[model samples]
Target chain A: MIWQFDLFILVLLVITALVALKVRDLLSAAMIFSIYSLLMCLLWAEMGAVDVAFTEAAVGAGLSTVFLIATILRTTRRTTD
Target chain B: MSDVLTFIISRFNYWIYIVLMMIGLYAMIAKRNYVKKFIGMSIFQTAIILFYVSTGVKSGATIPILEHGHDIGHAAAAINPDHYANPLPHVLMLTAIVVGVATLGVALAVVQKVHDQYETIEEPEILFKLGQE
Candidate 1:
């Protein structure tokens, strides 16, 4: 039963990765990447690594996303492709 | 049957962590944009932290604090006196978190400079402009 949740997270991670790769806009890609990080944090928590999950949540989901958005703001939002 | 299934299921998290990590690394290396690279870097760092924390788990173990009135020396030999995980990983994670933040800060500052000088962040375009000059 627990494996079901793990499998779900895996699927979500794959979908997010695909979106990050296929998205033409840089900002949207960064947003999807942030979602990927958040899903990873949940996976960590499920693995009994609460401390790691906490760090991932705080740094990956919070700080890193903000940093990416700030970078996007400073640069062009469009992709040539 | 259920017990065996449960045993296999327990290890599923590790597999997912590894998969996500590989994807993140691949993106970091293949992506051209500076910001995308930084996002990939953070994802890669996060995956490693997840791997480390997962390794610290011991089945049926409790947090690593001694109970009130418990003797430290005597409790050391007890079979299940709140079998705490290795705190080393937690400590290491704190350091990793700090380092990750530092790396992001430096990377962002560099990106700012790159934007200021090039007036663009796209890797190929920047290279083209540099070649033109």
Candidate 2:
């Protein structure tokens, strides 16, 4: 019953998440994190949890990333880790 | 062989979720930047939400919304609960999502204030500054 499309989405999700965590530039990390969030939204939608997907798209892709980038704007963008 | 394939396919989503959870856990525990830890915490929350939502899904069930034409006059007329996904988890997670946003907002504000005072967002540097004062 596993859909090929869902499997593809999961692979991309994992890759984006890892890159988001590993990237040096805070801006790049924030952008990649949005990608991760959107993929998660899609997954939840496919799973019949439309409410969760909608919330994730709004909070994760929209508000959370914007706030993270705003914080970066206020502070330095470089990270030692 | 097909039996094993079916079993793995049926259960692989949970496995993937577990791997994602571990990644977030490791990042939260080992990342040096305060923002990174915040990201990890959010990821961890997402994983838990996903797990709970998946639990409410019944195989072959549709979305929880009731059909418009269905009547409630009798036991047979009622919309069978098993025909739709369970909605309790979805309702609870609604509150969780709002709380998560508030948490992220508060966490980022704390990070901003710490950066303003110490001029650094790295944990080690913040600790160093705190130790000096």
Best by TM-score: 2
Q: What digit string (tens of lDDT, one per residue) describes model 1 on residues A1-81?
A: 156886888788877876776688988987898898789778767655666667778887788778878878877788753
The DockQ for candidate 1, computed on C-alphas, is 0.42
Ten-residue stretch with the least lDDT total in model 1 chain A: A44-53
Which stretch of 10 consecutive residues in model 2 chain A shows the poorest summed lDDT?
A1-10
lDDT of 2 at B21: 88
Tens digits of per-residue lDDT for model 2 on B20-43? 888899899999999899888888
Name every residue pair that clashes in candidate 2: none
Q: What is the C-alpha lDDT of each candidate?
A: 0.75, 0.86
DockQ of each: 0.42, 0.69
Candidate 2 deviant stretches above 4 angstroms:
B1-9, B69-78
Query: For residues A5-76, what per-residue lDDT tens digits would candidate 2 score against the true structure?
Result: 777887888788789899999999999999999998998888778998899999889999999999999998
DockQ versus reference, model 2: 0.69
lDDT of 1 by residue, B27-50 (tens): 778888777777667767777776
